[model samples]
Target: MVNDMDNIAGTLQQSLIQIITSVLTVIGVFILMLTISWKLTIIALVTIPLSILVVAFVAPTSQRLFGRQQAALGKINDQVEETYAAHTIVRTFNKEEDEEKEFNRRNHQYYQSAWKAQFFSSLMMPMMIFIRNVGYLVVAVVGAIQVIHGQITLGNVQAFLQYTNQFSQPIAQIANLSNTIQQTIASAERIFEVLDEPEMDDKIKETPVLAGKNLPKVEFKDIQFSYTDEPLIQDFNLKAPRDKMVAIVGPTSAGKTTIINLLERFYDPQGGHVYLDGQDIGSMTRDDLRKHIAIVLQDTWLFTGTIFENIKYGNENASDEEVYHAAKMARADAFIRELPDGYQTVPDESASNISQGQRQLLTIARAFLADPEILILDEATSSVDTRTEVLIQEAMNALQQERTSFVVAHRLSTIRKADQIVVVNHGKIIETGNHESLMNQKGFYAALYNSQFAGN
Candidate 1:
């Protein structure tokens, strides 16, 4: 709130300075006009004030038009960014011409709004000049009459003409200043809109102790959640023993990933509570809860860095030997050695230099180095080749030995060896058992499994 107040005060000060400077410049011009003839000074004073009044009346309308133009430009930028980010998807879906048309439509709208604003703003200067010129003509005629009648000297008439030019200068400056002030105001409003948005409450009130000697079980009791008003999961419950493998299987949008998000506290659940060793997850610091968990997402994201750096992201202080061991355990060492620079080879921006399988292996290596007590593998091997999948499976088997692991995958083959498989449908756990037991039940799990292995 204090920051907001400071920003508002700063903007007001700047705008006031601009307006005051413009008015002061006009007063300086009026002073020069007085050196002319008193008759011409009277004419100059009336015209200058009238021009200012006209501009003051028009300024608000011009601001509104300019604001609309700026908003249109912002929308065009958003569309361009979206189009570039989804360029591959757009091309794959043959949306090139369609996207081009949409872009053109938005571009045209921006052009129209910008041109309209310029049209109005441009009128101010020309209109001011025309009105000032008429006043100058009137002064010239009146001064000539006065000189002829011996009321004013010829030198005085010349001086009055010079003063008329001086007076017009400030009027022109004021018009430009008015336009600038409107633009500054428009920009401030947009900036403040973002600053005024509601931020998520991220403060932590307490910290939990995490150590090798005392690891606690994770429990979910009567948990319900939703991204919107409609609940995704209701009355959901689960308990993960300190060191056990729990595989959650579900069809698309059955809320499998939502559980992982809840566990990580990316979002708080709408109802019930998540407990870690009987302590509410919300009550504990978010960082403390996440320190014990290591997740390998399906869509692996590799920063533009060497394989060694990417893996070391999990633990910045990890020793070189620990990093090498983790890579070897994930079966990523073989590929790293094949590269020209081995572990030092820099990855491309989108990691296009490496195969999808290699990228997944690198992510897995990162998780291994973190040495987290709780592991989450979300479709970890879905994008890899069969041979690579088998290698990762072996690595995962070794890594899952002492940690509580949660595996979420659509590939039925991957979780066959899991200690327990919980089948979920419509955000509810419809079946829970081992591979053979779930198959014997002959429900959703059996049908899904049969559909995949029927040809085999």
Candidate 2:
């Protein structure tokens, strides 16, 4: 996208002036040629059609090749980004050679498309020059014949030839511009495709009435959703009361995260509705809805900034004192203060400067700063050690005091104390009860939970 934008910008800045200049020069020279010798002017004008033919033949091919080149360039960018981001994993798995081979393949694809595009575009200028020279030779011969027959003065014939040369100069200039024009069109096509895509639905208005005495903090009603054409979740319904911790657990591909995604409005259900505080979530603007929720994912995201800035990202208006307090609550303050620059320490681009657990702690601190009405922890403690996990669990218990919390966890021990344990399998809720009740029932949840500790 960046490369394409640069191409578009350059074309607009330079080609606009060149086009205007060429058009005016072509018109001015054509009139001069006609006034000097109309007969010779006719001969000069004949070559214009041939020049047009050359451009017609080459310009479309150049555009298509440039489009292919841009697509290949995009693939190269993706390859480099993925390879570097997963550099440690690749080295650990001894797959460096595989990564290098993939990168080389993408690079070669880019080279192939780029070479063809440039070669075709470069053909236009020389082709135009050849056609113009042919017209020049014919015009010169005819002009001399007119001069010999006393039909025109030698000076006039000479001036007409000069005018013919001037006329073809602009034509050649426009022909040369065809290359840049084709590239710009290819770039603009890509940009416009993105710009013209349908925007996410933001049609909801009017705050939902939360006047009911005991409305659920979050509720999903007869929900149906799927990432693909096949249904993944169907007829899913849940009512999570305010100030309660709801734990969702199941085997892999059990649509555990899909439930959270629906509540977060990341993907709206194809059917039914999600309500927050008695108002249909779909009837609320995403910004308005998201302001009430905070989520910490398994993969922590932090930019290259100080610990203070990273925590303050959740609430930009938060004071330095608030950031410090949030970090302390998340148990991140002690380690952060021990660092060389404490809160001022800048993390690397990938935040690899800090341990994985520390990165997770920073994200939790960020969530604390958000102070949202709802909290979501999706495998948030997965990266930490047992000791760190206990600290996080303690911090989370404190953070979940008043807010409704949803914990998607694989370690059943972490969510054993949840107010509600919802076991899902193949998208349907198979069991709903507290840990004690579910364990006593000896259902799927009990079997799954007991299996974890069976070996331990």
Best by lDDT: 2
Q: What is the TM-score of each predicted model, taking all chains together?
A: 0.77, 0.90
Candidate 1 TM-score over all chains jointly:
0.77
lDDT of 2: 0.90
CA-lDDT, candidates in order: 0.84, 0.90
Off by over 4 Å in 1: 1-60, 74-94, 127-192, 203-216
Worst 10 residues of 1 by lDDT: 1-10
- Return the top candidate by TM-score: 2
lDDT of 1 by residue, 1-456 (tens): 232344446647875776677678768767766665656788777786778787887788888887777778778878788889889999999999998999899899989988888888888887888888888898889999999999999988888787787777667767766666666566667777888998756765353433454534777889999898888999998878778888999889999999989999998888878877767788877888899899999999998778899999999999999999999998899989999999999998878889998899898899999999899999999888899899888888888889999999989999998888888887788999899999999999999999998999
Instruction: State the number of backbone clashes in model 1.
Output: 0
Query: Which regions of candidate 2 fall more than 4 Å away from where they truly are?
Result: 13-17, 27-43, 100-108, 149-151, 205-212
Worst 10 residues of 2 by lDDT: 203-212
- For model 2, what is the error of residue 257's alpha carbon versus the real structure, in angstroms, after optimal superposition? 1.4
Clashes of each: 0, 0
